[model samples]
Target: MPAQPFTALAIGEAIRRGELDPVALTRQCLTRATDSDAVFISLTEQRALVEAEACAQRQRSGTLRGPLDGVPLAWKDLFDIAGTATTAGGKVLGKTPAERDAEAVRHTAGAGMVCIGKTNLTEIAYSGLGLNPHYGTPHHTPPPTSSEHEHESRNENEPRAPGGSSSGSAVAVAQGIVPAAIGTDTAGSLRVPAAFNGLVSYRPSQARHSRLGVTPLADSLDTIGVIASTLEDCLAIDDTMRGSAPLVRAAAVPEQSVIVLDAGCLDDPRVSRAVGDNLEACASRLKDAGFHIVRRRVASVADTLEAITRHGWLGAAEAYTEYRALLEGPDAEAMDPRVRKRLEAARQMPPDSVVSLYRLRQALKTRLREELAGATLLTPTVAHVAPLLAPLEADPEHFSEVNLATLRLSMVASLLDSPAVALPSGRDDDRQHTSLQLSGPCGEDEALLRVALGASSALTA
Candidate 1:
């Protein structure tokens, strides 16, 4: 029989039509995981196969749940999976298992998606660069040339940063180990990796999904997100996560004014010429599609960075709050030094200053909404393509520098509490991927997805 398709929707459709068996599909993905097992902290092999068998039975009974029914996906290790240890990419979590699935995980499973495993992430999901000194970091593995189970003799590409804190989840989809995976975005965890690995990542408005079972980075800024190969897949999987189809408007005229920040935002020295060209080409294509492109200095972007500098980063402050006892206890010695340092910095923040920062953040959000108007904003998801892994592993200082730079643009959307999608922007000189991000007003996720759907063809053209 011919090899089954790789995307979730396609695979689900095949299963629904009896062209593919869910059990067989699950086995194929499990086999793929074997070669890149470093991507996962734990594989729910027995559980997944059992789930797949039931899904296969459901398909035969004409009761497949939905487009995601029987489809296998990986989750970032931060999410609670009943009976599995929720590591949050840290060594200090020990062996305690979660009694119930994360609300996000429950929602996805309820929609009939099978959980193959929990993918690795940056330690505590703290960094944009997907380095995990505790759990092994997952790198970008090239796709199989033939079947989903094809194993190559040798990998010619040098290992590069996977883009974290959703590193493994992004790699799983990018390498075709799975069709799609769930990731979390606090600042730029989802979007940065999507940019580095050539996948589409969606960051919903902060309040769109419940955060009950996922490990917290910053309660106020954290949001559940999905990384997939296409916008449509993201929409489908996002629907499953949200427990209903998004409130997407039909036949809504595409917004014509595409807002762009000044060249300074896109001209970072880390950005490659190819990435710059690809971004320009996407803008030009959108302009040809009748969208009027406008360029300006978005003062809000600057204001966000200033706020972080003045009041200390909310992510750091909140993360410190969540992990204070742990960091202060003896187990703190086991924590990733990089993450420990960040939380320590935030620990020093004055209680009153953190409170004041929240007020400033509220004001900034309102000011940005008015300044941006209805024009959707566009920017490169990261300043550079994924960096070589060796140097980053060897130097903590270098890792911190690159990690912060990788997050510069995507963090803007997070600060504004806006919905954003990062779309692949072709390849850079090293053949590594880069991405362009489309950001819309706060709480307008579906609207942004619709705009992205309309503009996707041009962006990918």
Candidate 2:
């Protein structure tokens, strides 16, 4: 009603229809950026202006690029923007600017999307918690900038977290400051934040989007993903970010054949409640929408999680080795200690174990396609809603327990080498939702997105 927040596609169309000026939009975006302390890390104000002007000129000439032409978006700071050095959430990456943008940024720009700035992220994009000590953590969208100043959260007693590692990107979109944002998901960086921020997001298959110039966490599982206001917006960003022009595949069947995960492994009461409630509601919607929903056991549900544990995350180990030099300095001491400790796990993991993990990953991927055909596997994006920050930060055990649960379901996609996307199911006791993950066989990015689209649409309905 009040300038509907989930309308990035309409925003793009408004620009196309000449009802909005790209330059003015960029200026407003930059103005918002100025006061978005802690929410945004870098402002591409000057560059955004240049691009916006060009888009406006093209509009005047009636040569506008495409759907997202003149639209403004932000990249998670983990991405390397052209002429902006990627700090990757660490101060050690000093004043050096990137010579070129990451492949997704370049593609998005080529499609006429303007980069407002880089959003904040977890240091080295490690934690799903989005806690960064080097660069500040990105908080969730605050109350509106109005004289009334309605406190958005309603409960002062409840602390907030935006989720990670794409924390600021989600905050940016959720706050109505950006149409969409980009972030990487080696695990659930894109999905976690989206769920926490109550926005639409998708992590397409691992290699669906190019990884060139994106700092890698796990070479095999790392993927560039998007956060937007709608499923269409997610699909559009996907199209713009691909090398071969990503296409959303049509449904193999008119309805989703789903396996409702009955795994008892989810011990967290809060997480189980959020996930269980949503699954029940979603199953009902799918049935009403003419999709077949069934409560059935998904094979390898627990085994896959066990595999990820045995793997100890090949990506984490490799990422630690990749950034070993930068993480060794005095700057490392200043980083969020939790983040530093997480990276230390990488150093301790044997390379041989990492190799073993990759083999397991490939095998599990085969299991998805070969063993489970004509069905989609559903799991909670996070075991719980975004927790109060202090407990996780102050208590190592708390952080460990939360991190394990958050990543437990997400790591399945990495282990299986399947394409997984997290969809916001519905609000629960926390007035928010646990992200629901849908994973498909290898290279089924399109199918995964379509399923996510159906789920997201149903939730809003």
Candidate 3:
């Protein structure tokens, strides 16, 4: 009878108290999603209602599976949901309904979470900008109370990039259609969208979770992750997907050391004044909160960038290999032209260069791990806030430039196989959300997440 709680954990708590019906909550989410455009590739109404009913029965009988049981979530279309087409934001892929759920989906279902639907993404999850010419792009509509002054200065209807390849996942949560969503990050898919939409995203080390049944862009770099409204929600979904009970909560802000990378370390000219200032302010807040803040350059960070500059993206070369058949086949005509161009460009990378990049990545991973021994590294999630969509959509060159810039910072974590969390720091002068990323050594996901909880609290406070 009352309005449904807005977060997954809160909804689960209400259900536990016999204060909310999972069936009613599912229907409410379905209704909201049905009215949205370009956010969902397809709705799993029958499946969601069925799952919610079972969860309700479990709660009634005192057989609840976990804390997130009965919570609704959207999966990026790259993940296979039995009986739903896994479009991967392409006109050509997943024409037939998948026969089974992705490994992550199966785990979440095992925890009793409901699948509301599949959200749109960059075609083949290739671009940083969440544009899907085939499915349309989902724009982030700033909440009315977000910033009244900024709303009056600019057209509220002006289209901006939603950050992709998890574009719709972020927007779906931002619009309050669902509490959380599953997405993948090869370079920066999950974090970029979260940054743009003012949400939290966690990209775990590639080895921390199962990737089975999920579509792959680059088997080497692709990682499945969660996008949600808070760091706690991200952690809960992460635990469920890993087949663990949701036991991790934002614990006491642990006394930890945090390394703030020098702004000059990025070597990216596109890094904006607003982003830099906000990152510094966040560092100041953390320092004030008793975090040992060390400001210096990380050699591994510089080395990784140099390797990328010399060899190009290792993922691009791998992606070309994964989809060469489709890219060369006649069906390639159906692919987005921008995506096609980027994939084709990888063809120019020599075989030896790809191998060298792989070797460099392994070496850098070790270097990064040794550099941060239980300490967290903080950096800007992206060099800038979401850019206006119209200009980028209208020019392929501009699109490519912005896409590379958007992914610059996130690629560092991917290459190092490090676990990272992107948290909304504050709004820019334009009132666009700016984000700060906290990352740590590879395979140190839990530790980094704990540190992030503390960092997030300090920054938001």
Candidate 4:
């Protein structure tokens, strides 16, 4: 039989049919996880094998847990795994291991998913660019060296950014080391990385998943999300995490308008023509798929940006509140400078500013919902494809500029409390990936996921 695609649903089905042994699958994933660039910060090989052995036994007894049973996955290092340090991709955290698995981890484990290891991330899940000074950034594992041929714009040797705070999680899946992984999307951490790596990522409604035992970034803005190769896989992981019933057939695509925002940022010089073209292609596909595509300018989007500019981001304020002690403590010197700088800046903002921004954000969310009522909003997940890692790391100014620009579109969804999914559109001129994001009204995640599944197929096709 042909090898199944590297996805939870595929692997688990094989395990259930007794065609694949769970212990053997666990070993394979562990081997690949170690070989897949710098994706994993730590590997739970022994425990994973033990769990897989049990899963295999259960399969023999006709006690299969679910679609994810016996599947291997990596967790972003920020999640607390029992007896492991929750590093948050920073050096400052002490060596004390967590007492138990994070709530989400426990949920998945209970559903029989094997935990392969802890994946790396941007320090404290702070940046979208995924460059981490402490835990080295995980890049797309460069294609093997070959003397066969070479192209001018392409060097098979140079590594590209994997999209961040959830950098390692994306790399793990993209490299075929795992079927899926968990990530936090405070401001596009999950979506940006998924876009850069050419994978499926779903940012559920903020209130959908429990945040307990997960390291906080921006408590209010932060959301639990999954990165996988397909929306079905993401839905499976999400369903397991939420302890929901088996996923039913996705609802048929709704015949509603999709608002495509074309503003300065969308047309900004930083956005490559190829990226813009991909966005257009995605819009064209959606229109061809029987959905009305409306080109419109939303003033509330400007309001969202203005609020961020006038008052520091709500995430920045909230993250500062959560990590201020560590930032100001004696171990402060050990923190990543890039992350430290941002947190320090947020610390300087007045408490009243955060309060005012929160109010403004709420009002803007209301305005955006009203403006986009009965329709979904679409945008390029990021301005450009995965950037070369070296140049950005060499220049902090450029890093900061690109980082903010990359977050420009996805951050809007976060600000408005919308549930969004970043679906791969296609590859660009450099053969790097780009994605189109579909963000719907809050609490409408299920419906949006269904629409996205259809749109993703059409856009990619």
For every model shown, the clashing-pair count is 1, 6, 0, 0
RMSD of 4: 2.5
Least accurate 10 contiguous residues by lDDT in model 2: 142-151
Instruction: State the lDDT of candidate 3 residue by residue for 1-461, as single tens digits.
Output: 23232778888899998999999999999998999889999999999999999999999999999889999999999999999888889989998999999989999999999999999999999999899899899997654545454445474457789999999999999888999999999999999999988899999999988899999999989999999888888998898999999865554354545565654544456788778888888888888888888888888888898889888999999999999999889999999999999999999999898999988888998888888766788889999989999998899999999999899888999988889999987877567888889998888888788788887777767
- Model 1 has an lDDT value of 0.81
lDDT string for model 1 (1-461, tens) is 12332677788888889998889889988988877757888899998998899898898888977878888999999888999999899888737999999887888888788899999998889999888888788886533344545443332278888898999999888777899899999989999888888889899998888888888888889999899888878888887887874334342244554556446666656566777788888887877776767767677767876777677667778888888999989999898888888778776789877888788788887877787787777878887788888899898888878877778777778878989999887765456777888887788777677678877866655
Tally clashes: model 2.
6
Every candidate's lDDT? 0.81, 0.73, 0.88, 0.82
**TM-score, one value per model:** 0.92, 0.90, 0.96, 0.94
Candidate ranking (TM-score, best to worst): 3, 4, 1, 2
- Model 2 lDDT per residue over 6-76, tens place: 46567678888999988998898888877775777888888899999999999999998887888888888
Model 4 C-alpha lDDT per residue in residues 95-188, reported as the tens digit of each score: 8999999888998889889999999998889999888877688886443323445343554347888888899999888877888898999989
Q: Give the TM-score of candidate 4.
A: 0.94
| C-alpha positional error of residue 369 in candidate 4 after TM-score superposition, expressed in Å | 1.4
Sliding window of 10 residues with minimal summed lDDT for model 4: 143-152
Cα lDDT for residue 455, candidate 3: 78
